[model samples]
Target: MLQASFGSQHPSSDARKVADWALRSHDNRQAAFIIIDKRAARLYVLDEAGRLRGSTSVLLGAAHGDDTVPGIGQRAISEVRPGERTTPAGRFLAERGHNGRGEDVVWVDYDAGVSIHRVLTSNPGERRLARLASPVLADKRISYGCINVPVAFYETYIRPMFARQPAMVYVLPEVKSVDEVFAMAASPQR
Candidate 1:
């Protein structure tokens, strides 16, 4: 129960629920944080005070699972099956870093090779840009576990937040309950 406000931005019910829990329980550790609502295909960036910094639609894994397949990160991208591609749900202490390509990214789970970076338009056939612009939720699911955001959004919101310190990223589960994914010591059922 946040007495004040979640923020000026209007997030989905699930996103607000997780954000409220994180803020009330001090789960964000006074750091900037993000809430990714998988079901809604949206991402919310908030400051330490739980004020909305920005929000945007994002591209998630092609698969619908909340957990990543074991050892999938160790394998080449080409070897990963469609079903193995999943942006795992849970809280991640994410940090800003660069990929092998030297592009800046917010590493959600470095071990899992999951990061939040600008959308890739390398393959026109994938129509990543088109998918991003589409209002359809299903069109947003075409990434390989990584979270893809618009270039401007990534630069203006996500990058600066993680440039100096690590931040908490809570990816809400699609198949599991919020309680199951977070299991916060202070979380009470709504």
Candidate 2:
């Protein structure tokens, strides 16, 4: 296990410590859901038994920001904008699915246009494809506010979490408070 130290001045120090502890002790045996830390770039999958099944690397949003709806006649808002490669930190749900131009993908309703999906890498010339598959991307923040993963990996492992019930995907900039995220999840529209 990794350990991080925060000075007392941190705004959410207590919350961060608690979240860190939860992450460490998460038993994936019957987790049914997961919460990915953008900064950590780690995928924590819990099985039906709630034991920590294991962790894997993932590619995340290259640009980070709040998800917003675009006004009519305006440029469509992108969940991830170029050069802002930081994924938003919050709690979200895997609420839907989409035909990602032919690739199968599970859509995570981050409420910010950001969703976790299969990494698009059909083109040989795309440099991002290599990065998307790198182990380095797993434990660090990357992507445009969306979690990207190997298509087969998602189909084999992560998809089951959303089978009978909607699964939660909590993304955080760093280990911080979960109150806001939990509140959002408990909201009526969620």
The most accurate candidate by lDDT is: 1
Residue-wise lDDT of candidate 2 within 1-190, one digit each (tens)?
A: 6222333323233334433443454422223556565555666664443345545567775544433333211334343246444455555566556543554455665344456676656555555557755667443344545677777667777666566566655555443444544443233134
| Candidate 1 per-residue C-alpha lDDT over 74-107 given as tens digits, one digit per residue, 9 for 90 to 100 | 8889999988889999888889999989998989
Q: How many Å off is the CA of 5 in candidate 1?
A: 4.3
Clash totals, every prediction: 0, 33
Worst 10 residues of 2 by lDDT: 2-11
lDDT, candidates in the order shown:
0.87, 0.52
Task: Name the regions of candidate 1 deviating beyond 4 angstroms.
Answer: 1-9, 186-190
Candidate 1 whole-model C-alpha lDDT, 0 to 1:
0.87
TM-score of each: 0.93, 0.62
Best prediction by TM-score: 1
